[model samples]
Target chain A: MEYLSMLPGPTNVPNRVMRAMLAPIINHRSDDFVELYTDVVDKTQQVFQTKNDIVALSASGTGAVEASVINIVKKGDKIIIPVNGEFSGRLAELIEAQGAHVVKLQTPPGQNATFDQVKEAFDNNKDVKAFYVVHNETSTGTMVNYLDRISDLTSRNDSMYIVDSVSILGGVNLPVDKWNIDVCMTGAQKAIAAPPGISPISVSPKAKKYMIANPPPTMYFNLARYFKYYEESKHTPFTPALPLLYAYREALSIMLEEGLEHVFKRHKVCSDALYSSLSAIGLTPFAKQEDRSISIIALNYLDGLEDKIFRDTLADKFKVLVAGGFGNLKGKVFRVGCMGEVNKYHVMRTVSAISSTLAMMGYKTDAQAGLKTAEEKLKAL
Target chain B: MEYLSMLPGPTNVPNRVMRAMLAPIINHRSDDFVELYTDVVDKTQQVFQTKNDIVALSASGTGAVEASVINIVKKGDKIIIPVNGEFSGRLAELIEAQGAHVVKLQTPPGQNATFDQVKEAFDNNKDVKAFYVVHNETSTGTMVNYLDRISDLTSRNDSMYIVDSVSILGGVNLPVDKWNIDVCMTGAQKAIAAPPGISPISVSPKAKKYMIANPPPTMYFNLARYFKYYEESKHTPFTPALPLLYAYREALSIMLEEGLEHVFKRHKVCSDALYSSLSAIGLTPFAKQEDRSISIIALNYLDGLEDKIFRDTLADKFKVLVAGGFGNLKGKVFRVGCMGEVNKYHVMRTVSAISSTLAMMGYKTDAQAGLKTAEEKLKAL
Candidate 1:
């Protein structure tokens, strides 16, 4: 049974993208692969809205995030990470693992770090090497709404601005170049609608310069090696996951064909519909209105509604698979992904399924009202 | 045109394995994913022939090798790596990147590090932390044939025995437990015939203890985190490449169904055919017969045969893709993969293709004789 994936990532891959995986494997060093890889990288740069070189890594999103950190942050380097959710907190830990002194600007799980908070962190810390932040905190369904504003502080301080846009990039407007983002990493499975595994990360020339000067003592996650290989042969340093590359190329083509404006607008409509519909069904939105994620929709569990039972019922009965919360929010919030190939049909079915599941769990919810609300919002798509 | 992949890795994925990737994405934390992941790990362990725990990392073969090295070798740790081929040399570099003192046992290309040479290294270096070797060096088509014996040396010295069996595990008999290999890593694409990306690595209890005692400062490649996640739920530390996992599971299923003994025998017969046929066509085998890789057959280019022109003719004219030699052997040798789904038909087709390509290049070669030789050897399969 194929349950609808409504989790934050590894979302419902479109048939076009999934079918692309059926293409025969090709030699990564071959001309055909060079063409496929170059095209994928170019399309990835377009989606990132950056002129920076993109490296398609054959690892998960976390690997790319690690690459972004280990490449720039050396020992004793002070790096500021605004931790608002599980993903951001993990990023801080990853930086600390590099022997860097992480100055974390802690925020409540449901809220994002404001520009003022980050600016103050920059002011407090001297010679900060980098500012790392998760653009979209999938765990809490919160997004930093002030990244464009915060980029200014990093720019003024001359610190590398690294953004983990794993859950947001293709679905949201993240202009890496405009924001002066030195490194922006994203997973293929998220808004890109490709299969999981490949993470296409955009690296600015500044970041590349820093990395080449102080190369990480790593082989597989070494960004400098990727740059060298890309420059020399339009190839990854290692054998890439060829099928995922194919799927990613196709997914990016779909995104480009629809136009980034339309893709971002569709994501906005879908997430809006989810938020409004779930809110109407007596489920409170987890994040504050101003900071809610436009990709992952997080909702507080209704009073007396069991978390496992609710999700289980949704999966087993409705075949709609949603995610329970992570860390502190576990059993308190449920997350539904509104990114990646999500359309009016998906939004409507998800709203109806949640409504029906909650009602089945003996919660007071109007299924018709939820569906109508979702239908109205999705009309924008 | 879909050229047949005969490279050392990213081999021709079977249609069943490729189609398995079309399965819709699922939540990594879900029970369904747990089932899928657990089964894949179990089958991977079977291929590895190990009773140890297997960590299926969502990275390439090199990433797994990096994980194995970084997890165990701390700063200033002395690790002996035999450098005979490109892969082994890279392994030494990865170990060195971890700030470990790499004592390289340098052997010429197309030759394996003898048991005596490794023993000499261990004797000379006191308190050696580990002994790393590439079981099948794909770049030079050479394999260390004394791993079982070398494992004893590491066991006696209480050093970790790490083996990079990335290109040969499924198609060859590598009993990790029997050989006392502390860390054995293999990629899914090579021999396993799954699409590349996921690298399933087996860790013995001893290696795990050492890793837990001295954890690497890494997030994504952290083996400890993987252990914790697998213990809590049959899940990886982060989101896995779901479609690749599906393909890996199907590929493993095919391997298990065929039985390891039969698989190993088939690989032996296939390589035997390639060796006899290609040798008959006047292309000398690059690796000495004693140390040659059974999975990757490396043959020297005939005198006056241009490497690019020969391989191009093979690819364009006959729709067969083979690899050129690496490093010093570039343009000197050609490699054909005789692993995974490679049977009598592929053997005959490849032999005929090579012979005809050589003939087309104005070289003296008997295509009929090569085909007949391949047919005679493939009868064993």
Candidate 2:
């Protein structure tokens, strides 16, 4: 049986999207593929609310982040990253792995970095080449605010601003061009509602210029080569995963059909409902107030409750698949993804399932409390 | 209309494979995905004919090639590469991009690198860290012979032996263990008959050890990380392309059920039939007779015919897809891929289509002559 994949990525695939993926694979250089790429890239830019260039890469979201970093800066360059969640830590590691020096704007999980905190990193690093941030911290369900402020500071300096919006691109309002982001990328499996193995990355003129001057010699994730090929042949330098592009096209159609503002508001309604439901069941979210993500909801296990056993109960008994925290947050909280096709029904079921599971484990909780709260919030939608 | 994708890499995916690809995508870190990955990796080894570690990367074949290079050696290291085809040229460039010194055993297209030539390069550049070869050079349809001899030479020294069998791994006989190949990678779209996203790479213990020590800073194509993740958790370090893995498992099952020996023999039979039919049509293959590939057939265009227009006529009129050459060989010849589900019927149809297209284009050709030859060769199969 196919479980409902409520993880941050590789979520449930809609029937139309799956059918789209069933189309026979096409040659990457074929006219059909180029049209597909061009159309998808064009639609992707509209969803991103940007007129900048976007590249569709055939790899995981982490690979897109690597492409951004490696293409922009090389060894000995300094990059400042805000390290709050697992993905942010990954960016920092990837930056250092490229032989670049990294200065961390450290923040606790579920917390946002103020503009002054980012400035502190820049002040200490002085001559920083780039600033990396995770727009939505999937690890703790913290959607960081003050990105515009951070972008303003980075723009004043010569540092390029890169954001990993992997878990919350379409569902969140991160107007890439307006925020002055040098590069922003997200994978298909998350809010885009497509399968994994493909990620779309948008690049500002600033980042494109940086790539042209100092290109990485990578055979894959070579954005400069990709840009050149798209300019010349309107295709990727390497073979793209054709099937995923079809699915992405269908997903983007769904997004555009729903309209961007309506999609964001849908996420907001579901997120608010989930937050209220969890609170009604006496569960506190891991994220700080106003920093909680519409993409995911991370809730800490009540004192004396076993997190793993609770999650396993949800998966095994109710067949509700949720994710556990990573790194420092492991075994302390569970993460429920509300990205992509998640809606009021899924939110209500999730909250109800959690409440019932807690009560099944002998915890003091009202049986219909979470569900009632969710219904009240979702009634208007 | 979904035209046949008969290109070397993105061949027509079978119906069963397409159906398998329709499965709901699961979380990459879920128990289901781990099981799927383990099962697929084990079966992939059977098709690869090796007991070595196999990594399933979410990028194209070129990404896998880069992973092999970055994992094995870094800057200032010496390596020897054979530049007989377009792919080998790519290998040389990748080596330089990694800041390594490349010693080239150069040969023109349609030619195979001699063992003597490789030895000469290694002798001149002593203590070479690695030796790179393309088992099936997709560019000119040349499948190099005497790899065991070349592997023996590389073995005599401590040079790591890496092979790019992107176009011909399952169809051609490349015994990884017996041949002492450190790493051999192939794309899913080729002989495996899966979609284009994932590439299976078999790595020997020697290569794994080398990778552990000289790890590439790559986020996506880190084979060492993949190895560790598989060992500890039986999954990829990053999000894997789930749907492709399902289809790949089905594809592998198809090959194994048919038997590897039979699969290889089928490819041989098809290759022989195509060669005879092409000969009957007065088309000279680009590759040397003995160096011809079982997976693809590349033929030099007749002196006066435009290869591009001929290819377009085939696509527009007959709905047949064949590729042309790249780099120096561009516009020189056209390539027909006969891997995966391609068989004697497809070959007959292709040869007939080519002859018919040539005839329509005012060339003197017997359209039925090629079909007659193909049928005779395919009768025994």
Candidate 3:
């Protein structure tokens, strides 16, 4: 069956982006390859809004996340982590695997932890060496405003702040430099509209200083080795996916031409339309309006409806795919992604598809109401 | 200037394969995606010549290597790895990261670790858990005949045999079942003619028994988690690159249609012709004849000339890109690849390009003689 991807990642890669990704692969050591790689690094810097060394590694985003945890936190060191989403909780698990201790602050799904809670945890844990948080929680469409609060906490405690902007880097503005974020890493699959392989990690001077003091836990993820490899030869520690690197350079150029502000605005508009349409059909959003994600919308499914059935129906009947709630809110909420190449037309079509599919499934809802509401919202934009 | 890839993966992706790679990205949870992933896994099993659990990962081959080492070896387990090529040496480094001791066996470049040397080391290190080796050493173009020797060694000793066929899987015969290999892994970009992301790794029942006895290393590369994730969900440990996965299915289908024996024969023919042409130009091959790679040919530059100039000339004047010597052989040897779509015509064209380009650079070489000899070799095919 023909399918439309509205999942968080492996998001809809535009045809142009896919063509760019399919460009002929080049030899990594060649002069032409060096030029291409250097340009890609620069483009990533422009998008990241940071001048820190943006080292790209040939692995999944989880690999980079492990690198962040393994590099900064040494054995027996204390780390502060949040357990609100699956990804964040997984971060803590990785840290524990390194033989480090993680003190986690637990919160319910779709609920944002306040700065006070983080500060209290920091104040209570005197041996903490680093604090990690996810900027945008993909499991639940909740946005955490850590950039504004993390600097104060880290400055007061003299600890490193590792921010994960994997799903929100290009779709939203989280200036790494201005926020005093010690280390920020992102994946290419989500907002960059590129096939996943390379994850760009920017290490602040502070983070490098931390690495200098503490040895890296994993040899492959060592920042010192990365610096030597990239700074000396503009190559990775291992053989990189050359075609994916070329495709990223092309994807970054397209992002720059579109402008980050335009990208942010597009995401916001689509998300707002989705929220308005869902609410008009008598469904509530899982996240608070103020904390809702501009890249994704989490909908609270109506009473007596199982989410697996709903998600399957959307895929089987409407050919539109959406993510069901994971972890805590499984079968309670549905997530539709509006990030990267998701336009107003695509939003309207999705709303139409979902509304009709819901009606066919005998869910009590006004099918016309959602589409009308989405179109009206798009028209206002 | 248009660049050509001659390095071992990511190799030059053909237009047909690239177009297949450019296919639309689908939602990871969609049935279409599951079907695509299942097809890719099934096709990969066919290539690996095994009914074992063939799983695909969304990372580079090194990550797969890391996964294999970390999943199978416990904290204090002993590993015996050949230090023949750069990649096999990397296996030692990865084993060390897990706090395991590596019983290293020295095998210099342009040579393979003799079965006697490995067996002696295994005999000495009675507590050794696994013997790690690279099937095709792309660094030196030396292919080890491990299948015949390792089967006997593993039967005699209490150790598993893990093979890295990253550069040789499709181009060479690696009958995993017949070889009784415990763990074997390969990447797609080399001979599979697809972009790199997905790495196919198969673990035999013997390997699983060892893993169950040992503790899990890291969460990210946990084989138990990977098996559970795929067996239960039919997806990966994470969101995989949908387009690349689909392209791999297509590439595998093409490979199966061509037949494995025919594929290996074509690679052998091209490599022999290219090696003969290089020898005719007064360049000695880097790898020993007894253990030479059928897909990749390693040749030393003539009489102590800088290898960079000849490599640059070939890329600039002829647009025929060949890999430079890696690791210790850098600037001493040039590597000509004969894998993936490289046939008799490719060998002739590459020989003509290399001989003519070198002749123009004042190297006392006969361009016509090399091409004529290479043409005769191709006609014999």
Identify the candidate with maximal DockQ: 1
After superposition, the stretches of candidate 1 with alpha carbons farther than 4 Å from their true spots are none
Model 3, A1-381: lDDT tens digits are: 557778787677666766776566777676766898889889998998889888887666777787787777667888888777788778878888778888988888778778889889988987688888988888888888657768787888888889988887788887888888888988888888887767889999878867757755345567777777777788877656666777777778888999988887777778889989888877899887666777768888888888888888887888788998876878888898878777888888788888877787787777678888888888754
> For each candidate, C-alpha RMSD in Å?
1.4, 1.6, 2.3
Measured with C-alpha atoms, the lDDT of residue B106 in candidate 3 is 74
Which residue pairs show backbone clashes in model 3?
A: none
Error of 1 at B338 (Å): 0.8
Score chain A of each prediction against the true chain A by TM-score and list the results: 0.98, 0.96, 0.94
Ranking by DockQ: 1, 2, 3
Order of candidates by TM-score, top first?
Answer: 1, 2, 3
- lDDT at residue B194 of model 2 (Cα atoms): 89
Q: Which candidate achieves the best TM-score against the true structure?
A: 1
Question: Model 2 over residues A131-200: C-alpha lDDT tens digits?
Answer: 8888898888988777777776786777888888888999878898898888999989999889888889
Task: Output the worst ten-in-a-row residue range by lDDT, candidate 3 chain A.
Answer: A212-221
Q: What TM-score, over all chains together, does every model reach?
A: 0.98, 0.97, 0.95
Question: Which 10 residues in a row give candidate 1 chain B its minimum summed lDDT?
Answer: B143-152
Interface RMSD values, listed in order for every candidate: 1.2, 1.5, 2.4
What does the lDDT read for residue B289 in candidate 3?
83
TM-score of 1: 0.98
